[model samples]
Target: MKRKTLREEIFYKGIGLHKGEDIKLRLIPAENGGIVFKRVDLEEGKNEILMDIENSFDLTRGTNLRNEFGASVYTIEHFLSALYIMNITDLIVELDGNELPILDGSAKIFVELLESVGTKNLKEDVEEIVIESPINLTVGDKHIVGLPFDGYKITYTIKFDHSFLKSQMLEVVVDLESYKNEIAKARTFGFDYEIEYLKNNNLALGGTLENAIVVKKDGVLNPDGLRYEDEFVRHKILDLIGDLKVLNRPIRGHIIAIKAGHALDIEFAKLLKK
Candidate 1:
């Protein structure tokens, strides 16, 4: 497959998950720029953070990238997941805030935007990491393994002891169509009890019933119910795909993750890189 870029520029403005501020994002086509983030709010040269594993430094609610000069972009996993599935290898992501907007708390918005603008092929070959052997990494109870495969595959498992949710497991052979259908619409979810603390600490300030699935003890607070019964695990797979994209290539392997989050995802990527 030849390298791909967007057919036209796409734009969006939404609430930033961390800062709770309206942020603007513009996706611009590029020849071979790779997936990069340009912070329009910062000065030139100090405003860019190339989406590379080395630049991935934060492991909180989502994956974040920070440049040498300390310029940062938060919650990029959802957007990166869309780019990987869409096979978008080159583009300039212009952001007018510190975080990508948490649109519906899933990759659906970005996926839709990409589909609308479409893609164009370039002369460059597609970049991918074809694994030869198993790469395993673990952090406490969370772990991930990458094994050889013909295409990108993700097997994600999530476990919560809550009454409404116990265990969710899903394995997906990810492609553009599969991603959009199976994973893109699964919104991020959080416990109702954590809302006050998160808000008090200025974290996840943009979270609400509209963007994320707020879980109560016995059910969800979202009146729309669920998009999918197994959405939780599917969203985990989505996050992993985005985190792996930090390797700066498509991952041609089967990734098995158990209760893994941003921190463990970065650790697994480091092992894959070496």
Candidate 2:
């Protein structure tokens, strides 16, 4: 596969889930350089953050990246997941704020926007991270393992104490079609009981029933129910897909994860790099 980038520029505007601030982003095609983020709100020369493990910043709520110059961006996993599934390797994401818009709290909108603009292939061939040996990582009860595989695959299991969601699991070979049809629409979820605490702590300020799946003790708070019966686990797969992009190349391996989140994902990424 050849390196890919957007065929033309596209713009997006929405509210940040954590900061509750309006944010804008412009996706510009790049000739060769891998995906990079430019914080337009910061100093010109020091604003760029490359899409690599060296920049990963573990945040409580989302995937974040910071540069040596102190420029940073939060809540990038959704967008990055869409780009990775689309096989986009070269682009510049220009952002006007510190966090990406939590559009619908899933990768669906990002995937749609990217498809609308289509993609252009560059001259270079694609590079991939092919696992030659098993890589196992365990942090307490949570664990993630990478094993040799011919195609990108993920097997994820999520367990929650809530009655509405006890245990969920999903396994699939990741391709654009599979992602769009099976995982892209799975929205981020939060427990209804946690809303007050999150808001009091200045988190989830922009989250709403429309953008996220709010799970109550009895059922979901959203009028529209889950897109899939096992959406929670699918969204976890989506997040894992994005988090692994910290490797900055397509991966040809089977990633098995159990009860994992952003922090463990980044740690697994760091382990994969070594």
Candidate 3:
């Protein structure tokens, strides 16, 4: 497959989830360079973080990447996930803050933005990762496994003790259309009990019912209900797709994830990278 980049420059502005600060993002087309995040707020030479498993660091709440100079960006998975399914391989993402905007807490907005501008293929070919055998990584009951497959697929299962969200399972042979329709709209969710903990940790400061699904013991707090019946699990699948972009290549495999999060996803990605 040919490497892809955006057809033209695009810009988005919103509030950073962790810092509750206004942030601006600009997408610039590149011929063949891999996806990179540049912190325009920082000094020129030390502000870029290339998306790679090696640069990934385990952070609470979301995925993060740090450059050799210690410039870092947080909460990148949602944006990366949109780029992955869109087949966008090469581009520059410029950010004016340390974290990305948590727009509606899903990839929906990003997907729409990409759809509006579209992508163009470059002259270079993409080397896709084709799993030939089972690759497994487990952290206790959480596990993610990639099996040999001719096409990209994801089987994600999520479980919680809460009555409103006990368990949800979904499987899909992924494509751009399937992703945009079935997965992109699912919003990230969290329980009301998690609010204080997240704030104490300096995370989710910008999160509101508008951006995330806040669940109470009785039901959802959002004025509008879920987009899908199994939106929670679908959102998990969305996160896995974004996290997998750390591999920096298209993957042709069946990924089975059970009760996994950013930490396990990064570890699984490292295994896939090797």
Candidate 4:
């Protein structure tokens, strides 16, 4: 099938996850086969940086993209995940800062915003990355594997030492229609012990009970509790899906992941690309 791109302009603004600064993002349609990030606030002579696998840099708590010009964009997984799930083959992402807004700490808000504006289809065929061989990576007892498949499917299992989390498994068949309803609403989560550490280190500054699920040693800290029974593992699957989107193409494969995080996710993507 021919690829699809955004049909209209969509804008969002919020605070950055790490920088704790307000940021603005605008998604506009593009007629080609690539995604580009335009740093509109840059001074004269600086050019817009395109999003590509080659530009992928350090995989800390989030995904960061950079170039020799020192221009960088951080925590792009959520936005990229939305785009990938929507099958948006080309786009021009205009941003006024170095990081994407951490709106609600999940891709739900972004998905809603995009759907409100509606999507446009292009006259081109969609291209996908069909796995040709088994790709696997292991770290301790945690591992991730990708095998050839007809479409995109992900089975993620997370094992937490906590009593509440323990071991939970989630399998999602990722597609444009199901992404918003099934995966987008899963919020990112953190441990109660990490709150002070994150704040002191200037990470997850915008996080709150409203945007994320906070788990205490004994149980959940949120009054409303989890949105899903296995929300923690589901959110990990969400993050993994977002991270894998960095490949810049819809993948046709089955992924089995165990206790994987950003680092392992990126490592798996790197191996898949090779």
Model 4 regions more than 4 Å off: 44-47
Model 1 stretches astray by more than 4 angstroms? none
lDDT for model 2 comes to: 0.91
> What would the per-residue lDDT of candidate 4 be over residues 1-274, giving only the tens digit for each residue?
5667776888888888777788888888888847888888886446466777778788868887876687888888888778777777688888898889988878888877877877677787666778878888999988999988888899998888886668889888888666776788888888888899999988887777887788887788889887888877777877888888777777889999998888888888888777
Ranked candidates, highest TM-score first: 3, 2, 1, 4
Report every candidate's CA lDDT: 0.89, 0.91, 0.92, 0.81
What tens digits encode model 1's per-residue C-alpha lDDT throughout 113-212? 9999899999989756888898888878888988999988889889988988889999999988888899999989988889999988999888788899
Rank the models by lDDT, top first. 3, 2, 1, 4
TM-score of each predicted structure versus truth: 0.97, 0.97, 0.97, 0.93
* Residue-by-residue lDDT tens digits, candidate 2, 14-60: 99998888899899999987989999999989999988778877657
lDDT of 3 at 225: 87
TM-score of 1: 0.97
Model 3: CA > 4 A from native:
none
Against the true structure, candidate 4 has what lDDT? 0.81
Output the lDDT of residue 69, model 1.
98
Of candidates 2 and 1, the better by lDDT = 2
Evaluated at residue 192, the lDDT of candidate 2 is 86
How much does candidate 2 score in TM-score?
0.97
Clashing pairs in 4: 1-126, 2-124, 2-125, 2-126, 3-124, 3-125, 3-126
Measured on C-alpha atoms, candidate 3 has an lDDT of 0.92
